[model samples]
Target chain A: MNHFFEDSVFFGVTLSFLSYGLGVLLKKKLKLGILNPLLVSIVITVIVLVVTDMDYEIYYNGAKYISYLLTPATVCLAIPLYEQFEILKKNVAAILAGILSGVLTSLSCILAMVLIFNMNHKQYVSLLPKSITTAIGMGVSEELGGYVAITTAIIIITGVFGNVIGEFVLYIFRIKEPVAKGIALGTASHAIGTAKAMELGEIEGALASLSIILSGIITVGFAPVFAQIH
Target chain B: MKYLRQFGIILFISFLGEIANYAIPLPIPASIYGIIILFLCLELKILPLSSVKETGKFLIEIMPVMFIPAAAGVLNVWGIIKPSVIEYIAVMVISTIAVMAVSGLVTQLVIRLTGHSGHQ
Candidate 1:
């Protein structure tokens, strides 16, 4: 079994697809917030390697190809942002302000954590991009000399947390406007929160999509500046 | 054939972004440069929506799966992360909620102040 997996050129890719597919199925069946497809996929993939005693390097040999798509996939994000452009135009100021505040809040919070917890610069930079999408966040983390893997995990955790409590937080704040709700979720949670936004209403969904792109850009520009703090 | 062309366009833009990243002194990543360029092209009607729409959707749909390899790297660094796990979780939870509340409230306030009605 080890030799077979070792020699197969496509073994890692095959396992990834199978695990991710299973994760999607489980999410559909279980309907649990903690059962995020990405989280499930990671768990399954990790378990498979550990149980099989397979080397992570060997698994990554085939898995690396899939990561090559990350850049193009991020570029494709522009399409959705473009599709939602008209809605963005209608309430530009409110959307921009909302996303800006969210980005600032994210930065300041990370800064405070660094000071309060006495986190090293590496840890500080890793968490700086925690609230953005995984693709962009990973890039920011790498550029700032932080652990990209830890940043990815942190990003997924943040998104999952946001998805779970996003609506509840909005309700507590008495934020009734569709635009405000969308901005809050997307700005705070990235794509995972956008999933919740999609459930609320069409306007909220569109606005959330827009906020994801805008907030990502804002974080990219600002993460470097904040990384300078520690 | 169509999907191939769409992918080619995205790849070309990404290549351009790579060049820009090397040229620009800022800390911005190539992917961001690609995003900005693609967005401008679409906004200026330089690239029609149909040119990249279908393939773009396909790529985005599968985005999460692409992160598996990177996320799995965490297993190797567990020792480094173990001690600070609690602090990491604390910062994430506190900041996430704070950001959600602040962003929502500020947007709500701004919309009201601007008299946009926000009803639409």
Candidate 2:
């Protein structure tokens, strides 16, 4: 009876794309700002994995290729950064300042959470890279002796929120400029936020992409200092 | 052919990044090297933007597709993370909003002071 599904080799990869297709369909059909396809796909995939009694490791074996693609995707962001080089040259100072503020805010929040919640060493460290892109966040988290799986979960949770409410926050704050919007999205949400930024504007996409990298670098630096404190 | 060439440029840059990963003694990942080198390449005219712009855009546009598997992998560690689920969710939400508000406002203020706040 279960022979058909016993292989589970291609199932993971095939399911990922199929769920992504469903996510796209749902997003188009619902037209909700918060309807992130990645989030949707994960939810659906998780349910399917649970229902099918599939071990996550088996699923991961095939899905890891998609995960590997993140490296090149991170590399691809350079194109947008280059496209908006002029604005970058002009607003370098402001951009740096904004990144600093964002980095500080993220760190402080994590610090407070760790202190308040009394989280364990690994838990706190995993959450440290919660706001950056997955590839960099995974590296930083692992360097801090945290689990990559936990770090990714925290990161996606952060990104999903930022991708959804990021624009609403800007609208409320009256942050009309592309640079400001992009910085906030990228700094707070990483790649998913950058995707939202891309939808917002070219300038936003460029700045958000830049912000993703900068915040990542900042988190890498911050992780060491954070380790010393703990 | 155009897409292939553009993708080739990105892959080639990523390859260099792998080398820089060993050459440089930073915790920074190879992908970061890829980004930095590519930026320098585009800026220095060593690699023309027109060559890779479309392909780069396409890859980045669909980046969410790549993140799905990682996010789903959360299932593997959910048992360990389940205890602090509430705390984790709270921290993520609060921190995201705080970071966004602080950075966005600070950037807007700084750019405004520079007298160039026309959304650019």
Candidate 3:
């Protein structure tokens, strides 16, 4: 099997698509929030690689092509933000305040962990951008001398956690407003959380997407400053 | 043909973003630049929504799948992460919940105080 596909550029890409497609199917059939397609796909891919004794570097060679699409996809997020311009205009103040508060909260929490847990500077900075999307978070982590792989993993876990329990948390906190719910998910969990927000409502999706960009920028500005703490 | 064009536009903007990312001194990523540039183009009507809508939706819909490769990269670093995994989990869970609660509540509070119900 390895010899047959060893030289193919599409090998890893094919595996990713197949696993992700199966994940989507499973989610549709199971109706479980915890059955997140991304999470499922990662598990499946990892299992396949481990079972096949394939080197991660080999898998990433082809898989990197799919990753290449991430920037363009991120650019496309502007469409949703543009489409919901009216609501955005009306709630500009609330939107800014929500995202700002979330960014600050995330930073402060990381700072507190540094103090309480006695975490090293690398670990602290790695966790600093955990709340943002993977693309931006990885950049921030690398810039701050944090482990990029650790940051990516942390970001994914943060997003999956938010996607799974975002609604429950909102309900528990009595957060009934659509804009607020969107802000909560996006600010706290990035695009994956926005996926859940999109399922909730159109306004929610737009607001969530907007928060992702805002929170990400704000985190980039502050991450370096926070890195100086330890 | 339409999707190809739309994808081309997005790719072109992303390339510009990469350039800006190199030119700028900030820590911001190229993707953010791409997002800002594309957004400005839309807001200014230099690029119509129809030009990128379908392809944009397709990209967004598959956004989750894009992270798989990077997320899977985590497997390579388990040795470094294993010792402190508990602390990492602690910080992530606590901070994530705190952020969600604070952001949601603040947005709601601001909306109510600003004399808007939720949406018009």
Interface RMSD of 2: 1.6
Error of 1 at A87 (Å): 1.3
Best-fitting candidate, scored by TM-score: 3
C-alpha TM-scores of all predictions: 0.82, 0.92, 0.92
Candidate 3 local lDDT, A27-118, one digit each (tens): 89998867877788889999998998999988988999999898898888888888888888888999999999999999999899878999
For the candidates in turn, chain A alone yields TM-scores of 0.75, 0.86, 0.88
**Mind giving the per-residue lDDT tens digits that candidate 3 earns over B43-113?**
99999999999999899888878878877888888888899999999999999999999999999999999
Q: Count the backbone clashes (under 3 Å) in each candidate.
A: 0, 0, 0
| Candidate 1 wrong stretches, greater than 4 Å | A118-122, A133-153, A156-178, A189-230, B112-120
DockQ of each: 0.58, 0.74, 0.74
lDDT of model 2, residue A202? 85
Compared with the true structure, all predictions reach lDDT values of 0.84, 0.84, 0.89
Candidate 2 TM-score, C-alpha based: 0.92
Instruction: Name the runs in model 2 displaced over 4 angstroms.
Output: A1-10, B118-120
TM-score-best of 1 and 2:
2
| lDDT agreement of model 2 with the native | 0.84
Q: How would you class the docking of model 1?
A: medium
Interface RMSD of 1: 3.0
Model 2: per-residue Cα lDDT over A1-230, one tens digit each: 45545555677778888898898899899998677777778889999889988777777777877777777878888888888888888898889999989998998889888889898888888888899877788888888898788888889878877877887889888888789999999999998888889888888988998898899999888877876665
Residues A78-197 of candidate 1 have per-residue lDDT tens digits of 776677667667778888888999999999998998799999999999999998887678889999999987898888778867876887899899999988998899899887677667
